[model samples]
Target: MTPEGKALLNIVILGLGFMVMFTAFGTCGNIEQTVIKSFNSTQFHGSGYTSMAIIYAVFSASNLIAPSVIAVIGPQLSLFFGGLVYSAYIAVFIHPYTWSFYTLSVLLGIAAAVLWTAQGNLLTINSKDSTIGRNSGIFWALMQFSLFFGNLYIYLAWHGKTHITDKDRQTVFITLTVISLVGSFLFFLIQKPDPEPAPSDASESLLPTDISDSSSVVASQGLGSQALDAFKKSIQLAMTKEMLLLSIPFAYSGVELTFYSGVYGTCLGAMSKFGGDAKGLIGLSGILIGVGEIIGGGVFGILDKCNRFGRNPVVFLGMITHFVAFYLIFLNVASDAPVAPEEGTQMQAYMQPSVLVALICSFLLGLGDSCFNTQLISIVGFLFREDSAPAFAVFKFVQSITAAVAFFYSNYLLLQWQLLIMVLMGFWGTVTFFVVEWTAMSTRKNSDYASI
Candidate 1:
């Protein structure tokens, strides 16, 4: 196969690998609260939410060092090792302990930082400006399929019941472990691209020559030097006006994701009258989210490829969708509503307006999320080009910190307050996107004039 054909093939394989890994680990991440709440609410003092906060906090910290780690090991090896760390974290459930759980959270955090940093770098470096949106869209859509199958497995495991038996929990752990292992193995099949030469004219590059060269340079010095340089580059990028403007929306996306993965399932479980079987209701919500994401990704990718809409318009639509979903959630659903069984048959209960509203909220959240996330990656790739590793690292850094803060306060806040905060953030994010787009257009016009 030609190099171009091989590159495309590798991208698809990597996407499929992530789909498997995410299905396994994503299921654990999404539904763990319900499972933990069911098994031993006292294990963390019913503070699974706090545990997640701790993980993202550590993840935020690790982002500072992750880029250097990827620089040393390369993206493919970084992904392989990171996948193994994820599998180990999943295996922790077999012999559960409080200390072990928190310890693994730290490991998972570091691993996540490495894995995602590598992924963004790999995808950006391999793609061209014209096709970047489509690549990201296809990749995200495929990865989200894990949510569908993972939730499907949970639904089957519960047997339409709300609570999970000890046997079922054990089976879940084992199955997830095996699936993660398979994903790690698939990373070995990916071939890393050869490094491109540094641009001759520094004026044409977004990054300095030293930093651009750093991408091709291995860690020949001591670990401390490599880390120091990486940290400096991260700070430099973070301080750029474009990066700051883009960060507002990126950080808000983090909070939105935390709500869907952490709080949404809990809300569904709380409203169900079927006892432990209510967990199945949460699974159903996840499936709907996956379906929405698939549709959103496909549509956005097509529009982008056809030049039907600019990135700003698509992102604006996403912000509006998110605002509407949150508003509906605030108005129609009550987390503290009494859990009396429906007056009629099971099907009638399932068809209740409030329940249906919650499900639709889940779908819209996923759809809006896909629109923003795919565009965020594509836009960053377009702006930064060769210096994408540090740019993506900073992006993840801001997102992690924001998400950590959201999860930390999540326990203290009521559902109404949480939704209100998200609405406010969404508004600010949309405004910031407008600023970022305007800046980009101005910069491009000047560059064109200079060329003329």
Candidate 2:
């Protein structure tokens, strides 16, 4: 096979691997709060929210050190070990316990840190300057399929049930654990790309330098010093003017991600109006969300390859779509629905809950999220081409911190307030993103003029 064919094949493999893993993990995550609530309503009241909060919190801290760890271990091994840790976290659900649940959440967070950073590194290594957007689109589109299939399983398994039974829980989680393991092992199947020859002219190169050099450099350092240096570089990059401005949207992505992935479905399950079919609706909502994401990723990916498509339009699409979804959620779902199941159904701020409106909201939220993320990935890939690992780490760090904060507040805040916050962040994030884009464009134009 040609090297280009091999690269394309590897990108597909990586996407498929993630698709399988997240099918299990993402399905489980969508229902996590509700399932945890089922464990013992009195004691585990908001433990689902709390567990998610913990995962992101640890994930946030681990990003600082994850790049160095990836440098030491290499992206492939990091992926394998990370997948194992994710599977372990899913297994904890099979025989649910508070201590084990929180403990595994912590481990999963650290694993997530390494897993995602390795993914970014690998993706960057495999892509050329022109192909980054196309590759990212393909990867994202494939991964989003997990949501559709996983939720289809849920919709089939628990469709008519008022509540999930112990037998039901055991059966579902066990299957999910197996799926996650299979996905993890698939990472082993990915053939590592041969290291690139050194660039003769660093000043003119558009692609990143090979990660092989960084790996050798880290290999020579003590582990502690490597970690400290990685952390320092990440902090420095994050403090730069462009990254600082970019962090606003990055943080907003985190907030919106939590809402669509976990909180939205939980709200659906909590409302009394849905009753016996709430679980079914949760599954359905996930299916629609996945559908929207697939459409967005596939569409944007294709358009991006066409050379005429611009990033700003996608950003605006996401902003408008999210605003619409948030407003619909505000109207159709109860304000208190996200707080906890028992106390959630007392009030609806506007229209009564309809299954149709709920599903629509889910679809829009998913589509909007895809827009924000694909653009962010493209932006980061463009701006930080030479420093992919730490750049992605800082991006994840800011994103996870905001996700943690959103989860923390999801416990205490009403649905209305949460949507309001999303609105504010969405607006601010969009504006700041434009600022950075304009600045980059201006700099590029100036450089071109100077050369002339």
Candidate 3:
């Protein structure tokens, strides 16, 4: 590769690695997952979905704070430290330190938040709009695959024909701990290429290049120029109409994706990733979802109706497809009727309705996740000018905060009242439906926000 090409290649690899570590947190970081699955019964008892959700939410809660740290310190350090934090968190579990679990949860949330903002900012400045969306799409899709890998690795290690022993749970923590440390070393390779100034109409400002020893950017100092805020503005400025229109149908899928990614592993453990009819179906579900995501993300690039029907319809189709998947899963869950296997050590865990529900949910969630992410970025690009970095950044910041709060709340509810979280998620989906439809129609009534 030429010097410039090499830099780009390295950056992309860094970004990809960053995603790998970031995503590894979802599966490998879940202490509840490793402990509950490995040590517990074949039925995958007591995930503490509520407790784990709270832990996960506590970890996610740091999004409220990490952007400030990132804008001040900058992206490279955020990633380096984030990796170290993950290493520490995993090691805590490896040694079976229960007290560190809560503290580690919060730290992981905060560290990941900082890393996400910094990397997002870096990508915004370094790449073309189309290229950015495409890269983001690919990275997001690939990141989804990481969970499968984590599952495969953990399942194989446990190797439970009938049941997994708790002793092997140590392997899960150790594997992740090592991976996190290795990621830290890789983090050193990340270096800021250069700083670029925000445009005249820029609602947000990029960090200045005065790399202090502490490693923060200008935006990190409570300036609130974080990506979510930028993203919101870009949507409001460029294609408020188009986005609201698209968002009407698109929001339901978003709710589904968030809810399912949060729960898929729990389902897999109960179904067994390595064996049985349920296990076979569980594995099949994951692969199919990954494949669906690829197809959905590709659609983001090819859609030509953004100029006319707005970007709403593409999202609409994506949501409808997701709805079908969810419906199928719900039926499976509701049935509660058991399936009898003709062979092998059929544990009491197989043919679980809840696991079936989650499988259906994961597939639909994956489809929407793969499609919506690329579509969202592309939609922002269509709505905003090429130089609208600040706007997009703000958009991302808001989305992050909202997502963070929602994640926490989901867990809190799960803990407080088990089935309530699902009801709430479904209700949230209902609300999203109206938001998308109303926003789309309302935005279409006038060309007011059509500057781009």
Candidate 4:
């Protein structure tokens, strides 16, 4: 075997490229700090909150399609495309122009979307049978670095500035652009096994069969029609009480993303009246998540290992963690702290204990968040046909589409701090947890994205 094969050197190297993929997506979190700052800078003006919401909506919505495109183009080409967007539009290598800034946000959304599909496909494709499980472990473990790296990037950008000025923003953009380019170039060198053979039965299906071919597929003929068809099929298949319960966890996970990636820090700022330092806490929140992932990561694998239990318990654990974590945040904000047991005397409700509790609670929230993500992608592979890239594409698409709406509701519509609000989010996950448990999906290694 070539060194790249015997040692899987290329996959190892491309992990950096994948790192860029994640950081690209992760930059979304920084929007709360950056977008508002840009508008306030007088470099741009208006209630940019709407603009921010639109950007997020675009990011969330486009990410779904990105994977399907990645499935078709292959990872290297996708990375190249993603890199170009990062360098050109995101201007992470230099101060992006205002037009570039707006354009970059759109492109970043699209690029991030593409990266999700491409990297997941790539990583799964690259894993040699002996190494796949180990790689999966490393994949999740290493992704933590993206959060760390992104936070560091923001820190340096604001080293001396009161806020991230346009100049500072431009600097950050330029850096990522160069990095994207470098990562893109490297992808051309990495090789993996071709995806599993296209399903023979697909020839019998009404949809186009050849488009699923990775090397030959084009970007324009979207799965637009296929997406709807697949949705109906998945819905039809998922018609059981257990299937309905599986939907529960997804809602919680969706809300968690909105809160953490989309609005936690901003919410913190909204609570500025309470002396809460939202911005200062934003970067650190990732640490809480990382710490949580450590625990969840250690434990979730065992759940994935249990063949008889299927994925239910692990998925359940992840969902429960997320649900509780969000609950703490919800309660912290409302501070029914010191509910006055006697009901006659007023007590100083806002105490240090409550503050510490909220912060710790936020950390746990991140832990559950991490596990859910790890379980989620794996479950996608577990739940569907390995060769069914088209189906998984649909899966990814709905996830993004739904979450886009979730973000809209969280910040754009119901911008309030309440535990009941989280229940709405929890509804999806609660259903999903049961669905996976009750469903009879096989956990066999999918041959489609399997080995070289």
Candidate 5:
């Protein structure tokens, strides 16, 4: 196969691997808070929220060292290792204990830092400026597709049951663990692009360059020094003005991610008056979220390939979509629905809960999330082409930190308050994102005119 073919193949393989792996992890994750709550032990009280918070917290801190680690082991191996860790994390669900749960959360966090940084680096290496947007959309679309299958299984398993049993949880998780293992194995099959593109001359490359090309840097330095340099480089790049500003949307994505992935479902599951199995409804909601994400990702991916799409427009659309979703959530769901499931307590929503409206909000939230994430990936991948490992590390760092904060507060904050924070973050995040994007465009245009 040609180098381009190889690159495309690698991206597809990564996407497939993630889709399967996350099918297990993400499905289980969607029900985590609810399941932990089901434990009915004071020791595991609030464990779901706390565990996820722990994962992201460790994830955020580990991102600082991810670049250095990747430099030593290479991204593909890093990915393989991360996948195994994820599978292990999922397996623990079968017989979960408090110590094992929290310990694995920490391990999963570290693994996430490596996995995502590797993913970003590999994606950047496999793409040119023209294809980055499309590739990111394609990859993300594939990955998010997990939400559909995983949740469908949940819907089938828990469908008519008034309460989930330990047996049901075990059966579901066992199936998930096996699925996760299959996905993790696919990482080992990923072959680097054959006849890899030679490192571009930094001065001639259109994007700002950094010292992250492992092949070029590691050949000349000891492993220890190379690791230190990569770490330092990531820190320096993160401190750049453009990156600092971009952190706003990155953090916003985290908050929104927390909502869509965990809190939204929790809210729905808490309300039993919706005239159907609550777990089933949550599953259906996940399916819709997947549908919305796939539509946005497919549309944007195709349009960007034809040069009919732009990042700013998509970002604007995402913000608007999210505003609509948040508004709907505020109106339809109870303000206290997400805190915990109270015994014999009636749901006190702002308005009567409509199943249709809740599902619509879920779809919109997913679509908006894809818009922000695809654009964010394209932007960082394009602007930091040479330093993608560290750039992505910083991106994940900011995102995970915010996700941790959101998860930590999920147990305390009213749904309305959380939605309000999301709105404020969405607005400021977009404004700041526009500033950097516009500046980059202006700079590029000037460079083009100078060349002419």
Candidate 6:
């Protein structure tokens, strides 16, 4: 196959592998909270939130080392190793003791950092400037399919049961473990891209270059030296005005995701009527979130390819959607309505005006999230180009840190307060994004004219 064809094919294969992994892990997103909630009620009532905080804190720290690790192993091997680590985390669900849970959380944090850093490197290096936005959108859309399938499985497994039994939890965990292993194997199928010249000559390349490529040259001197250099470069990159501005929105995205995946599901589970069948209800919510993301990403990708509305419009739309969703959620909290049961109360509960409101809110949140996340990836790849490894690392670092803090405080805050904070952050993120993009665009125009 031609190099271009091979690149496209590799992306598709990698995306499919990611889809499988996400599907397996996506089940854990809500279920983990349910498991923790159950365990906590018996043991320590709010340990679940503390666990989440610890996991994300470790994840934030791991981002500091991810670029160096990816540099040593190369993106493909980084992905393979990361996938193995993720599979290990899934295996722990079988015998989830406190120590095992915390230990695996640290491992999962490292795995996530390595996996995402490799992904950013691979995608940026392989894609052309003209297609990066679309590529990111497509990749995200495919990965989110996991949300849909994972939730579907949950819905079927629960089968209208209000509560999940120990047997049911075991069945789900075992199934997810097998699926995660399959995903790990699929990583072996991805063919690595050829290495490019070091960062000094990166401007000569037509495509975006991997910052890790520079580490390859530096590694010949020594591993420790290579790591130090990568660390310094990442710090330098993070200090740039553009990167600093962009970090706000990136951090907000993390907080938003935490709310949707963790807090929203927990809130639904708290409803007396759905409390028994929380797993199923949360699964249904996941399905809606997935559907919204698919629609948002797919539509925006086409528009991006055609250069119809540009990045800012879509981002603005996303911010607006999030604002509306947060408002709706706030209203729901204020109303404090009761949820009726599933059979006689099932349809009424399903059709409960507030439930419908929340579902719409979830869908909009997903849509807005897609818009912000895809564009963030695209913009960073475009602006940083050759420095993408450090740029992405710093991006993930800021996001993880913010998410960890949000999760830590989530237990203490009221739902109304949480929504209020989100609304304010959304507004701030939007303004920051606009400022950054405007500056970047202006600089590009000036550069073009100067060259002419």
Top candidate (lDDT): 5
What's the ranking of the predictions by TM-score, best on top? Answer: 5, 2, 6, 1, 4, 3
Off by over 4 Å in 6: 39-46, 194-219, 273-278, 302-306, 333-353, 446-452
Candidate 3 RMSD to the real structure: 7.3
- Identify the candidate with maximal TM-score: 5
For each candidate in the order shown, give its overall lDDT on alpha carbons.
0.74, 0.82, 0.48, 0.50, 0.83, 0.73
Going through the candidates in order, what is the number of backbone clashes in each? 6, 0, 40, 35, 1, 6
Flag the better candidate by TM-score, 1 or 4.
Answer: 1
Question: TM-score of each candidate?
Answer: 0.88, 0.92, 0.67, 0.71, 0.93, 0.88
Residue 107 shift from truth in candidate 6, angstroms: 1.7
**C-alpha RMSD of each candidate structure in angstroms:** 4.8, 3.5, 7.3, 7.2, 3.4, 4.5
Error of 3 at 38 (Å): 5.1
Question: What does candidate 5 score on TM?
Answer: 0.93
User: Candidate 5, clashing residue pairs?
Assistant: 334-349
Greater-TM-score candidate between 4 and 6: 6
Residue clash pairs of candidate 1: 161-277, 162-276, 162-277, 162-278, 163-276, 163-277
lDDT of 2 by residue, 1-452 (tens): 87677777778888899999999999999987777766643433237788889999999999988887876677788888999999999998887777888999899899999998878877776776667777788888899999999999999988877777778888989999999999998888777565445655543322123333344454566666766766777888888999999999999999998998899998988787877788778889999999988888888764563334346778888999999999989989987788766323756558877999999988999899888888788778767777777899999999999999999999899888999999999999999998887776677653321211
> Candidates 1 and 3: which is better by TM-score?
1
Worst ten in a row by lDDT for model 2: 203-212
Error of 1 at 441 (Å): 2.9
What is the Å distance of residue 326 in model 3 from its true position? 0.6
